[model samples]
Target: MQIPWEERYAFMTKTHIETYELVEECLKINYFGMKYLTEALLPLLESSDSGRVVNISSNAGRLRFLNNEGLVKELDDINNLTLEKLDDLVKSYLKSFKEGALEENGWKLPGGFGTYKASKIFVNAYTRIAAKMYPNLYINCVQPGHTQTEGSSCTGSQTVEEAAKSPVMLALDDSGQTGFFYDHTEITAYY
Candidate 1:
């Protein structure tokens, strides 16, 4: 006999994976999804006379300098520090960003939760570097602040709408500024 429709739906939505598996899955999906989406947007932007590609990053991206302790040191290998490695990563990310694909070449944190923070960090760096490399493109990341969203576990002090204000502002900005980060609709220092 066939299983009930409700049972099948429940099975599909179940979040019973072990912590490790969950993290791996999150990283794989998040990184690859962003890369693919960005890649698709590049061409459209290139052909357009004016356009902007805004990434939804987080305040966690700014934690790098202030909280160096949590920063991933895996990419700090001596070999990775070479100009060649840096150049290649920058070039690859820029090509995708300029073209509209976002391939994350950085390491995925062992736990998927922090990976979001790391992703934001990568996005922030890529934004700054890409802006300089492709002056014609408006590439930037906007921190929505601590908003109460599903991913935020509803623990944040701000509402989802409040958190979204910053990203919305960045998306609508026509000031010609690129590679900038905004916090709650205002320009904020990131990194």
Candidate 2:
């Protein structure tokens, strides 16, 4: 079967999953890992007058990729998006992975980026959810532009210097901005 390069490139990072470990790992680290750490640090963060919770997330996690109207409405409704509900969503996502039906279920364009996107989607959502839960905390998530980090195998276009600025600046900013997503240095919507 001679698949064209264009088609291959389109899906270079995508395909129906034959293994669930990759998705599981992504969820464990990207979403739950952040959640657990933040929970453990809530006391310290609360004690500080200018508490900042900076989650280094990726642009891949944005809500734009989601075409599922119902899902969008649910995640967007922070007041109703409880931790238990979010956990349920994660569980459902994993179920989709096991069934190899992510694309069919309205999660799209992930290609090889499926699991990362899946986990990050939650990261962004949780960032907002937590921020609303704790009004005083300066909780924000930033997409530190694609950088040539070891995690990306040094393949990202932006240099570490460029990427570092956004997160660092957000960390130092005492502007009381919370539950927002950033594209580099600019304040932006979660989508």
Candidate 3:
């Protein structure tokens, strides 16, 4: 499948402005979107026998800036742009996910695009932590392989249904593997 990149800022006044606006919108979608999934959707799913919760995250949420455990650099064969800042950001994400509070005063911080990324990162983290906290829940996140969707436009080789396979696979994972990340049928890690 060949999906075109969705033009998120088609109505923008200029190119640079459009780019910024699109990123902003992506951040908002990610933040509130995950919140909704956790608050509204997960409970209902958990009540079912074949309970499953799948979040369609992005490779962008992988946070290449930090290594696992938020320690040293995760960049040997990989890139090493801003591992320190990435660690801090990932820590903030984990903190929020484990606890929940981007702001003490109930507001977003300045330059919160990282927070958006952190929110996605935290979703996967929460998936893991929640699974540990509750033994019977099956929760996972899917990168979805650059699929074409309403927000993403059509900019990938996968269709919505095709990209949807990863989540679907996790949902049907009778083996009970929780907090894993899948890109269709394959299992991949984000840290």
Which candidate comes out best when scored by lDDT?
Answer: 2
Task: Please give the ranking of all candidate structures by TM-score, highest first, separated by commas.
Answer: 2, 1, 3
Models 1 onward score TM values of 0.62, 0.88, 0.59
Candidate 3 local distance difference test against the native: 0.55
lDDT of 2 by residue, 1-191 (tens): 54555564455445435368877887898899999999999999999998998999998887877778788888888888988999998888898878877777765544467778778888988998899899989999999986777776455677999899999999999877888999999988877
- Write model 1 residue lDDT over 1-191, tens digit each, in one string: 64554554355336324254444455445444554576588788778766677877777666443233323352233223333444454345344434433324333323223445555665665566556555777877887776556664444567877777777777677888886877767778775
lDDT value, residue 71 of candidate 3: 28
Candidate 2: what lDDT?
Answer: 0.83
- Model 3 segments more than 4 A misplaced: 1-28, 67-116
Off by over 4 Å in 1: 1-20, 63-113
Best by TM-score: 2
RMSD of each candidate relative to the true structure: 10.8, 4.4, 9.1
**C-alpha positional error of residue 113 in candidate 2 after TM-score superposition, expressed in Å:** 1.0
| Candidate 2 weakest lDDT stretch, 10 residues | 9-18
Residue 7 Cα positional deviation in candidate 2, in Å, after optimal superposition: 13
